[model samples]
Target: MREFLQRTLVWLIVILFIGLAFWAFSGPIEGLIAAGVALLAWLGFHLYHIALLLRWLEQPTAERVPDGFGAWHTVFMTLYRTMRSQMQSKRKLTNVLERFINAGEAMPDGVVVLDENDRIEWINPMAMEHLNLDRKHDVGNQILNLIRQPSFHAYMKNASFSQPLVLQLTQPRELVISVQLVPFDSTRKLLLSRDITSLERVQTVHRDFVANVSHELRTPLTVVGGFLETLSDMEEVDQATLSHFLPMMMEQSRRMQSLVEDLLTLSRLENSPKAVMAEKVNMQDMLDTLMVEAEGLSQGRHHVRLEKGCNQWLWGSAQELHSAFGNLVSNAVRYTPEGGDIVLSWKAEGERLCFSVKDSGIGIPREHIPRLTERFYRVDRGRSRGNGGTGLGLAIVKHVVARHNARLDIRSEPDKGSTFSVIFQRERSAEPEAQPENQA
Candidate 1:
């Protein structure tokens, strides 16, 4: 108020000065005219400066204020400085906002921002993948309306969000999602989602593994325990009966031993970070050893043949490759009928070298083919037991192939025999001439 009064007083004094000066030269009427003209000129000067300021405000830039207005020039400069400061602050805030959005986009989990009314305000890229949301179209739509899951709706509606909600979505595919909400900025909410399908699968596998191990051990233990009780109860058991019972007990013990050994092999393969070291493995030598082992396992029950024409050497762990190759050959021999033919072949197909075990035995059903590599999975449990199989053969083979960066391909149809092939990467295979004779 004081500044306003001071400005008004100054303007009035300037007009009075003009009036007095005109009065000294002329009469009072002329002086009044001169004062009015002077006042009009000053008003026009201020109006011109104000117009420039308004124009600059509409589209501001780093340009100097227009001059020639005297006192008004100072005011214009002050306004320019204030505007420049505001622009700098706005640029800084925009940079920070962009960084925040980029960090959210890089995250694996999904993030979403919602208004007080549960309407989506913004979402990251991962949120689009997890929730199948269109960022542009989904904005302003209620989150509950889009998700529409009962568990999620109930959790969102509840007053407290103490725990996260797990939901299974079956749209794009089967997916398990864990969703949680956080209250922020007073009424606004931040929602987070994570895909837990793999974790859930691991948990289920662990449970089944424990139960299977217990069941496999329990059956043999019961058999051995019952036989021991019978022997202890009899005072004078006949020699023939004792011999028969002892052989059966030994067979049961051997079965248990094989199961334990397979379990150990699987555990070792699962825990190892990588192959110990990659060396040139002679495929011919490896196949020779497999043929001998297959013959022993077959016991003349099946005809086994080997057709070798691969590069002769592959770069990988010798033990691991041997184990993997031996498993496939032995499985073929075990499954083949007494008169059926089992063919083991190593040949180059395209860029890959394939080690295949083809058998003319009972083929696998289409439904069970996918899970043939699973531990303790058998098409016929009684048949596998009678053939002295521990059911962990294919599982071990799978791990070995993975360690060597190879692929396991199975083609089978029920009653038409089955073919199992391990296709090694071409990069890992070497020609006989490329490797030294000693190394080969």
Candidate 2:
């Protein structure tokens, strides 16, 4: 629209020039012509004045802002250079500004604009959302004062254009913010923040896992070595002495064994998508074998009760289901005292198959039951040692159940014993072809 007006003014100025020339050259011809020419000259001069105003409006910013002295003069030179650059490229200044603003808005990271007084001048939508900023109250507030974090304030207070301040948002979100201390004019600063919560979480879990695993292994290893040395140099190698120390040795060895197995299982489970299973399994036969093994392991005092709710042919990994079912039954027996009973049962719940092993042993506390599947977690450390438990039994069961697209649920009270269940998402439970024994 301004371009059109500018061209119109130029045309008006041209018409005025023609009229002025006619009045000045045709003077002796006619009074009416002379009067007409005078009127045209007056209109032309005014139109020319209008042209000057249009030209001023049309001038580049570098030309419009008059040159000042000293440092101010340097700004004009820089502005002139920018103006020349823009002109050389034949780009619209308004378009450039629009693109810049659009890019700022489109950024995924949070961005903030600060004025000379270090107050937040403007913030992008991401900044508002990521920082949980209240647009109503946050704007016009000092960035340093409002964000009360010492890290942020210090960054702002001691920032240089050469070095950007990168800090984490101290808020619960723990967002990673990389702030560019872009100094525009004497006081404005631009801050950019990107959320790294997920990344930080993954890194933290990795660190914890490494530290925990290392700590868990170190103690057992020290015991195993220390006891070996003591056993070797003992003067009296009698049955009574051997009996006392042998059990402790076995306990330490077993604990180490359990830790190693768990480490291996965890490693294997964490591998690629080939963690697969597709086979026919008779859960009854599987549970029966598991029962037999559990009884043998516990010496027959564990009376296991079995009830089948599905005779359908289950399809999945035979080994994984076996391990999962075995873990549930074995774990039940392990926690159950000598005379306690373990009940192995299964059913088809809607479209999914559920296999359960319940016990009449010492039950798990409500709090401890939640972490029952965590690697190396134990309800009673003493009881776990007495039972020769690796604490990876449930963890193994969990990963197996997950591979089968199933979920494991544990229900227990502090003293009434516990019921560990694996809800199989597979379509059906496999039936035993021959009469498979169920007395593990």
**So what's the TM-score on candidate 2?**
0.69
Deviation of model 1 at 10, angstroms: 4.4
lDDT (CA) per prediction: 0.87, 0.72
The TM-scores, one per candidate, come to: 0.90, 0.69
lDDT of 1: 0.87
Q: Count clashing residue pairs per candidate.
A: 0, 5
Which candidate comes out best when scored by lDDT? 1
Cα lDDT, model 1, residue 152:
86
> Over the stretch 224-341, how does candidate 1's per-residue lDDT look in tens digits?
9999999999898999988989988998899899999899889999998877435878787788899999999988888889998755588888888888888898888888888999
Clashing residue pairs found in predicted model 2? 291-440, 292-440, 295-440, 314-430, 363-417
